[model samples]
Target: MKSHLPEKIYLASPVWLQNVLVSTYGAFEHRRRYSGPHKKYVEYLRKNVFLNKTEIADLQSKLLERTLKHAAQTVPAYQALNLGPTPKLTDFPLLERESIAMNAEAFLSSKYKKEKLITLFTGGSSASPLKIYISEEARQKSYSFWQLFYDRMDFHVGDRKATLVGRKIQEPDSNNPPFWRYNLKDRQLLFSSYHLSEKNVAAYLKKLNSFQPKIIEGYPLSIYRLADQIIQNSIKLSFTPTGVSTSSENFTQKQREIIEEAFGCKVFDQYGSAESVVFASECEHGNMHIEPEYGVLEVLTNEGKIESEGSGELIATSLLNEAMPLIRYRIGDLGEITESNCPCGRASKILTELYGKVGAVIINEGRQAPTAAIAIAFEYLEGIKNAQIIQNEPGKVTVRLVKRTNFDSKSEEFMIWELKKMLGQSLKISIDYVTEIPPEHNGKYCMVVQNYYKFTVPD
Candidate 1:
């Protein structure tokens, strides 16, 4: 079996040497992700963001045409369709994860050799892990989109930042301080999400106070857990970040509220995928605007027809990533497009609702209930740090919760009452209290889990 030598070496080394090794790797990544055409792409994105809706549509159409032409010419998967020049976007079939995973190489561009392309493994938060390949230029350009969005929040390249994502910087068993490591290249302090707990949270807080990062970015669950610690302890930090950015997880409104209250800043949520298919970011007005230059995001109904508004599946077609173009990829997300214009004035498309994935929906009496709607049960209720609803049998759910000191039986009863109002009173509910709720292997929290999948029959 193939082994990760660097990971083995890092684990064997002392903590100080491990920090050195992490910084070394960080330096290498910094040069790779921000080098070459990254700056040029950032400049283009900055200018592209201000275009009117018509101009944005024209640019997307042109880019989409170019991508489709390249895919039809070079990619084995798309070439099979013989998509003629000037083929409409709808001409391509909907791409699913299974199709890509079963034959990933067929999707690669014949123009590039597999050995030269950069390979990436997704963390498998919403679905099974998938291996994706991209050209070096594609990788760097993908980073450029994020760099441009971060610039809007006054977080520039080389700015001091703190990240609380999936990276296991510290040993899981180590019960000590310094649950983080620094990367001098990007001036980033990488916090280990695995090590976050009530016992070690004070250390995390102290380090955040001392580091004084200009921005904090990470999975929403990790950041929310930290924010919960701060609020529960009533701790005040010495510094306030310019902004707090969250990605890689389904961020809820309650999580955003707690994070903003704890950090004393706005919580900006960015929507993108390792697939590089779609990109969206929250603006100052709190609207999530899709970056039309990055990709075309189309919301489709259950019948597979496109919808301008209302919640439906998100179909994404990449304008970038020429090395392995994915057209009309159903990325397993459910979203709602908005008709109301964002006051921020960016002419790109708007997403008013972005539920994590179709799997997040809970079912009762043959009807699917969005997790967002179920989550409203906890709204305005005190003394609940975290709650997760698990469904195994039809009309039955087990709610696991971590409670604050103020929690009482009344709070539990109120939550149950509120939940039944939406899920139907016939739904059976049970509560399980725990010291804490653990995150998924990828460090993302899933608030809703359905163990049985035969809820909705075929149409």
Candidate 2:
């Protein structure tokens, strides 16, 4: 019998893992992460050595100075930022997409030449296209924490693993070994997230069962969708994962419930982006704990004030990176600073809830959220592949679907009846079948798009 695992683990692994490995290696030079050096480092990190607000400000003081020193020598952008010495965090130049596009090298620090940087190509999650170079130390720091974060989450480095994630569309050369990371001693099944057509999902599932990874991570939407298909087929599975983590996209309540039901593990929801920082992760009880060790996050209101003590727009500063520091960088997402602390007793700030990305469209009418509740009806309906609620006009909605089979009248009526029960019958509902559902220009999976910004209220 094969084991079943969700297909989106790679996106969440970077930040947490980067912190883990660096912290561990620093503590003990020659120890395996699960045992000697790694264990001690995890203990020290979890208990001691986290920077608070004042401490972060102090670190930023030195970091900004170092960054300025580097930029003046290497980065053209900063010399051009043309600030006087002793620039405050706000004083540091803001490198939005426009600034980079205008003059890419202008952002480079003067200290290090462009050739010195180990460049990492960044496919901007937003519409922008450009490659950003990160310093070697910054790159190491970016990946260092994986072992440490896993230790924090109880995943030891020595533990064998399988990673189901998005990979290069072309299959690896057959002559090469099946496992890609040759240096890493542990075993892994590196399956491609893109090749998950229904025809091949079973094959992937079978391979995952054989690999039996202790931890599985990936984007939320794709993982849940694959799990839904696996569960629908009623294939017997024995996937006893210690943890399942999600990243790159928002994890809705509906998706969480379905993921748990399908995989039988807690969903460790991770938040952040590829270019900058790894902000938070869900504890056992579902509260989000931000990575206060390396980054500081602030919540600003729609009016651009820091109003959401717990939830608001996230304006973050990455304290760890001196390579290309993102000082008070605005990564668009709505959230609040949570007053509620977790029962687990970690003192890290809890990010109560994240309302997806700026691209996410939550269904609502007036001040009330009818679309929010209706969206929950899509937990894990067997045989129903994927569903998206799109509103083209007022009072009229379209339920676009990517189906596994043609919906008979009875099945369609049942779905409509369930939707009505959730979204109110007064709202006109139309169902459409398509070979594929298109994403918003930003390459984000938008579950709903209401052009008029008005939706039906649930009676």
lDDT of each: 0.76, 0.53
**Model 1 lDDT tens row, 70-128:** 99889999889987876787789989875876577999999999999887755233323
**Model 2 misplacement above 4 A:** 1-44, 47-85, 92-95, 169-186, 306-311, 357-459
Task: Estimate, for each residue in 301-372, the C-alpha lDDT of model 2 and write its tens digit.
Answer: 656565326555676766555566555555545577764446766656778767654223323221112222
TM-score winner: 1
lDDT of 2 at 403: 60
**Sequence-dependent TM-score of model 1:** 0.78
Worst 10 residues of 2 by lDDT: 1-10
- Residue 294 of model 1, lDDT score: 83
Per-candidate TM-scores read 0.78, 0.61
